[model samples]
Target: MRFLGNFLTNSSRRHAAAILSAAAFAGASSIGFAAPALAHDAVLSSQPEQNETIKQLPHEIILNFSGEPQQGFNTISVSRDGNVLFRGEPRAKGQELILDVPDNVRSEPGEYTVGYQITSSDGHATRGGYQFTVDNPDSSAAAEGSDDAKADTTATSTEGEQGESNSSVPSWLLPVGGIVVIAGALVLAIKRYRDIKKD
Candidate 1:
């Protein structure tokens, strides 16, 4: 009876130790996951200053983020009212996404909204917008030049739409699909073999 009691106590201690070790491991994993979440990319700065008015128009709208953007998923759009002013492929330099402004932008001076969507290197997407105004009072006199700018903006928007329509499956999807098909075929083959043996 004494030996039996000693064995039971030792077993309980071992079980408790395993549980404590598992809890510690889980705590460490939680911290590891949280570190990345806390370090997600965010807007660090923007050109033209949000809500600021400028006397001279900027050549481009620049956005700086806290981290590098995921390639092929970063986008920036500049619009005046509901009409797209500039839209095309976004260029990334370091942690910044740049949208090259068309020269005709100087012809129309009013409030413009710059919208940005960036997918971080970690596969998380972030989006935000800011507004800036051009304080050019003689914008009406620049209407002739504005027509060319408007046409350019329209072309850019059309190109953006076309690019979006060209859809190819993600690179990872092909391998995943092949693996699933192979697994299904194997399972079916095994079942058929088992039936034949049984028959």
Candidate 2:
């Protein structure tokens, strides 16, 4: 009975050890699966966050990441219906990247698609984008405004160049005009002198 008891006791201990070993392995595997999540750079937060709505447009978009992303290869852009409203050159500060939205956007009310691409701390490239909305869905005004802005820009540039050219014209014209006038007067005087002398 004593020998049998000892054998049973040893067997129970061996079984418990086996169970503990399996549990340890399972815990390690779960941790291994979670490691990849941390290894990759992910969006921690953002301005105009995913699915957020706003009343007005902003001059820039911002992103915060779980890890520090590499610089010189990051980009941020905002668009509507594939027409880009703003594309900013990403400026990285630690784990955050700030991008400027061009003023031409004029905060038109519509759904905007914000896209981003960056090199992660792990040397991997990450690409993603999200959509946001402005309460005013009347993009027609914004569209018209943008067109008018473009026309204004074109007109301004044309005016600027024309102004420069126009301002410079009289400078050269006065000299040439004076020379022609003086030459004509001299010719007329000589003709009169010869005619009078002949008479």
Residue-wise C-alpha lDDT for candidate 1, range 89-138, written one tens digit per residue = 68889888888888765436778888887787677777888998877766
Clashing pairs in 1: none
Candidate 1 structure, TM-score to reference:
0.61
True lDDT of residue 103, candidate 1: 74
Best by TM-score: 1
TM-scores of the candidates are 0.61, 0.51
Residue by residue across 91-115, what tens digits does model 2's lDDT show? 8899999987776667766788989
After aligning candidate 1 to the native by TM-score, how far in Å is the CA of 48 from where it should be? Answer: 1.3
- Where model 2 places Cα greater than 4 Å from the true spot, the runs are 1-38, 137-199
TM-score of 2: 0.51
